[model samples]
Target: MSLLDFLRRRGSAPVARERLQVLLAYERANRGYSDLLAVLREEIVAVIARHITIDRDCVAIKMDRGDTVSTLEIDIEIPHKAGALLVGT
Candidate 1:
Protein backbone atom coordinates (compact mmCIF):
# COMPACT_ATOMS: atom_id res chain seq x y z
CA MET A 1 0.00 0.00 0.00
CA SER A 2 1.11 3.56 -0.57
CA LEU A 3 2.48 5.42 2.47
CA LEU A 4 -0.32 7.94 2.57
CA ASP A 5 -2.95 5.26 2.30
CA PHE A 6 -1.31 3.29 5.04
CA LEU A 7 -1.52 6.28 7.33
CA ARG A 8 -5.17 6.81 6.56
CA ARG A 9 -6.35 3.40 7.63
CA ARG A 10 -8.34 3.89 10.80
CA GLY A 11 -7.59 1.41 13.53
CA SER A 12 -8.32 1.09 17.22
CA ALA A 13 -6.54 2.90 19.99
CA PRO A 14 -4.51 6.13 19.78
CA VAL A 15 -3.00 6.31 16.31
CA ALA A 16 0.72 6.34 15.67
CA ARG A 17 2.76 9.49 16.34
CA GLU A 18 2.97 10.25 12.64
CA ARG A 19 -0.82 10.30 12.47
CA LEU A 20 -1.32 12.99 15.10
CA GLN A 21 -2.80 15.35 12.55
CA VAL A 22 -5.56 12.90 11.71
CA LEU A 23 -6.17 12.25 15.36
CA LEU A 24 -6.27 15.97 16.00
CA ALA A 25 -8.74 16.55 13.23
CA TYR A 26 -11.21 14.16 14.77
CA GLU A 27 -10.35 15.41 18.23
CA ARG A 28 -10.91 19.03 17.35
CA ALA A 29 -14.06 18.24 15.46
CA ASN A 30 -15.39 16.31 18.41
CA ARG A 31 -14.40 19.11 20.71
CA GLY A 32 -15.97 21.57 18.36
CA TYR A 33 -18.97 19.26 18.63
CA SER A 34 -19.10 20.24 22.32
CA ASP A 35 -16.80 17.46 23.48
CA LEU A 36 -19.70 15.03 23.29
CA LEU A 37 -18.26 12.55 20.83
CA ALA A 38 -18.40 9.65 23.24
CA VAL A 39 -21.98 10.36 24.13
CA LEU A 40 -22.96 10.90 20.54
CA ARG A 41 -21.16 7.78 19.46
CA GLU A 42 -22.98 5.75 22.06
CA GLU A 43 -26.35 7.17 21.10
CA ILE A 44 -25.65 6.40 17.47
CA VAL A 45 -24.60 2.86 18.28
CA ALA A 46 -27.69 2.35 20.39
CA VAL A 47 -30.01 3.41 17.61
CA ILE A 48 -28.29 1.41 14.87
CA ALA A 49 -27.66 -1.62 17.05
CA ARG A 50 -31.39 -1.94 17.52
CA HIS A 51 -31.74 -2.81 13.85
CA ILE A 52 -28.61 -4.82 13.09
CA THR A 53 -25.62 -6.45 14.67
CA ILE A 54 -22.45 -4.42 14.42
CA ASP A 55 -18.98 -4.04 15.79
CA ARG A 56 -19.26 -0.79 17.71
CA ASP A 57 -15.58 -0.02 17.30
CA CYS A 58 -15.97 -0.15 13.55
CA VAL A 59 -17.80 3.14 13.50
CA ALA A 60 -15.56 5.98 12.44
CA ILE A 61 -16.92 9.45 13.02
CA LYS A 62 -15.45 12.54 11.43
CA MET A 63 -16.27 16.13 10.78
CA ASP A 64 -14.87 18.14 7.92
CA ARG A 65 -15.23 21.88 7.84
CA GLY A 66 -15.81 24.01 4.79
CA ASP A 67 -16.08 27.77 4.68
CA THR A 68 -19.85 27.76 4.96
CA VAL A 69 -20.81 24.39 6.31
CA SER A 70 -19.25 21.41 8.03
CA THR A 71 -19.95 17.82 7.17
CA LEU A 72 -20.35 15.02 9.63
CA GLU A 73 -19.29 11.64 8.33
CA ILE A 74 -20.01 8.36 9.97
CA ASP A 75 -18.37 5.29 8.45
CA ILE A 76 -19.60 1.96 9.66
CA GLU A 77 -18.17 -1.34 8.44
CA ILE A 78 -20.93 -3.89 8.35
CA PRO A 79 -20.15 -7.56 8.15
CA HIS A 80 -21.88 -9.74 5.61
CA LYS A 81 -25.04 -11.41 6.77
CA ALA A 82 -27.79 -13.29 4.99
CA GLY A 83 -30.82 -11.18 4.10
CA ALA A 84 -29.44 -8.15 5.86
CA LEU A 85 -29.75 -5.83 2.93
CA LEU A 86 -32.75 -3.54 3.05
CA VAL A 87 -34.33 -2.02 -0.02
CA GLY A 88 -36.08 1.31 -0.38
CA THR A 89 -39.02 2.08 1.87
Candidate 2:
Protein backbone atom coordinates (compact mmCIF):
# COMPACT_ATOMS: atom_id res chain seq x y z
CA MET A 1 0.00 0.00 0.00
CA SER A 2 1.08 3.55 -0.66
CA LEU A 3 1.90 5.99 2.13
CA LEU A 4 -1.25 7.89 1.26
CA ASP A 5 -3.36 4.80 1.89
CA PHE A 6 -1.71 4.22 5.26
CA LEU A 7 -2.23 7.84 6.28
CA ARG A 8 -5.85 7.69 5.26
CA ARG A 9 -6.48 4.64 7.39
CA ARG A 10 -4.82 6.25 10.39
CA GLY A 11 -6.98 9.37 10.04
CA SER A 12 -10.09 7.58 11.17
CA ALA A 13 -9.34 7.97 14.87
CA PRO A 14 -10.01 11.71 14.88
CA VAL A 15 -13.15 11.26 12.88
CA ALA A 16 -14.50 8.62 15.19
CA ARG A 17 -13.62 10.72 18.20
CA GLU A 18 -15.48 13.73 16.87
CA ARG A 19 -18.52 11.62 15.98
CA LEU A 20 -18.65 10.11 19.42
CA GLN A 21 -18.37 13.52 21.04
CA VAL A 22 -21.24 14.85 18.97
CA LEU A 23 -23.38 11.84 19.78
CA LEU A 24 -22.74 12.11 23.49
CA ALA A 25 -23.45 15.82 23.43
CA TYR A 26 -26.75 15.27 21.68
CA GLU A 27 -27.78 12.61 24.12
CA ARG A 28 -26.89 14.73 27.11
CA ALA A 29 -28.75 17.74 25.78
CA ASN A 30 -31.87 15.76 25.08
CA ARG A 31 -32.29 13.84 28.32
CA GLY A 32 -30.71 16.15 30.93
CA TYR A 33 -28.28 14.93 33.64
CA SER A 34 -25.53 16.60 31.69
CA ASP A 35 -23.51 17.37 34.80
CA LEU A 36 -24.03 14.02 36.42
CA LEU A 37 -23.12 12.18 33.25
CA ALA A 38 -20.02 14.26 32.78
CA VAL A 39 -18.77 13.44 36.26
CA LEU A 40 -19.75 9.81 35.90
CA ARG A 41 -17.94 9.53 32.59
CA GLU A 42 -14.81 11.14 33.94
CA GLU A 43 -14.77 8.94 37.01
CA ILE A 44 -15.23 5.81 34.98
CA VAL A 45 -12.52 6.80 32.57
CA ALA A 46 -10.16 7.71 35.37
CA VAL A 47 -10.55 4.29 36.95
CA ILE A 48 -9.83 2.61 33.65
CA ALA A 49 -6.94 4.94 32.94
CA ARG A 50 -5.24 3.75 36.11
CA HIS A 51 -4.45 0.50 34.35
CA ILE A 52 -4.34 1.53 30.69
CA THR A 53 -3.62 4.80 28.94
CA ILE A 54 -6.54 6.05 26.91
CA ASP A 55 -7.50 9.14 24.96
CA ARG A 56 -10.12 11.09 26.89
CA ASP A 57 -11.71 12.39 23.74
CA CYS A 58 -12.22 8.88 22.47
CA VAL A 59 -14.47 7.91 25.35
CA ALA A 60 -18.19 7.93 24.65
CA ILE A 61 -20.91 7.71 27.29
CA LYS A 62 -24.52 7.36 26.28
CA MET A 63 -27.68 7.33 28.38
CA ASP A 64 -30.91 5.82 27.21
CA ARG A 65 -34.23 6.31 28.97
CA GLY A 66 -37.01 3.78 28.80
CA ASP A 67 -40.52 3.59 30.13
CA THR A 68 -39.49 1.80 33.32
CA VAL A 69 -35.72 1.75 33.33
CA SER A 70 -32.72 3.76 32.23
CA THR A 71 -29.57 2.57 30.56
CA LEU A 72 -26.04 3.90 30.65
CA GLU A 73 -23.76 2.92 27.83
CA ILE A 74 -20.08 3.61 27.70
CA ASP A 75 -17.76 3.05 24.78
CA ILE A 76 -14.03 3.22 25.26
CA GLU A 77 -11.57 2.61 22.47
CA ILE A 78 -8.40 0.80 23.38
CA PRO A 79 -5.68 1.87 21.04
CA HIS A 80 -3.33 -1.05 21.54
CA LYS A 81 -3.04 -4.81 21.80
CA ALA A 82 -3.35 -4.72 25.59
CA GLY A 83 -7.13 -4.79 25.28
CA ALA A 84 -7.06 -8.47 24.44
CA LEU A 85 -5.28 -9.21 27.68
CA LEU A 86 -7.81 -7.18 29.62
CA VAL A 87 -10.60 -9.31 28.19
CA GLY A 88 -8.80 -12.53 29.23
CA THR A 89 -8.79 -14.05 25.81
Best by lDDT: 2
Per-residue lDDT over 1-89 for candidate 2, one digit per residue giving the tens place of the 0 to 100 score: 99999999999999999888877866767676648889988999999899888899989999886646779999999976768778888
TM-score of each: 0.54, 0.57
Kindly report which residue pairs in candidate 1 clash with one another: none
Pairs with backbone N, CA or C atoms under 3 Å apart (clashes), candidate 2: none
Report every candidate's CA lDDT. 0.73, 0.85
Task: RMSD for all candidates, in order, please.
Answer: 11.4, 14.4
lDDT for each residue of candidate 1 in 1-89, tens digit (9 for 90 to 100): 98877777755245666478765775676665675657778889888888888899988888776646778888887766712574322
Model 2 residue 47 distance off true place after TM-score fit, in angstroms: 0.2
Full-model lDDT, candidate 2: 0.85
RMSD of 2: 14.4
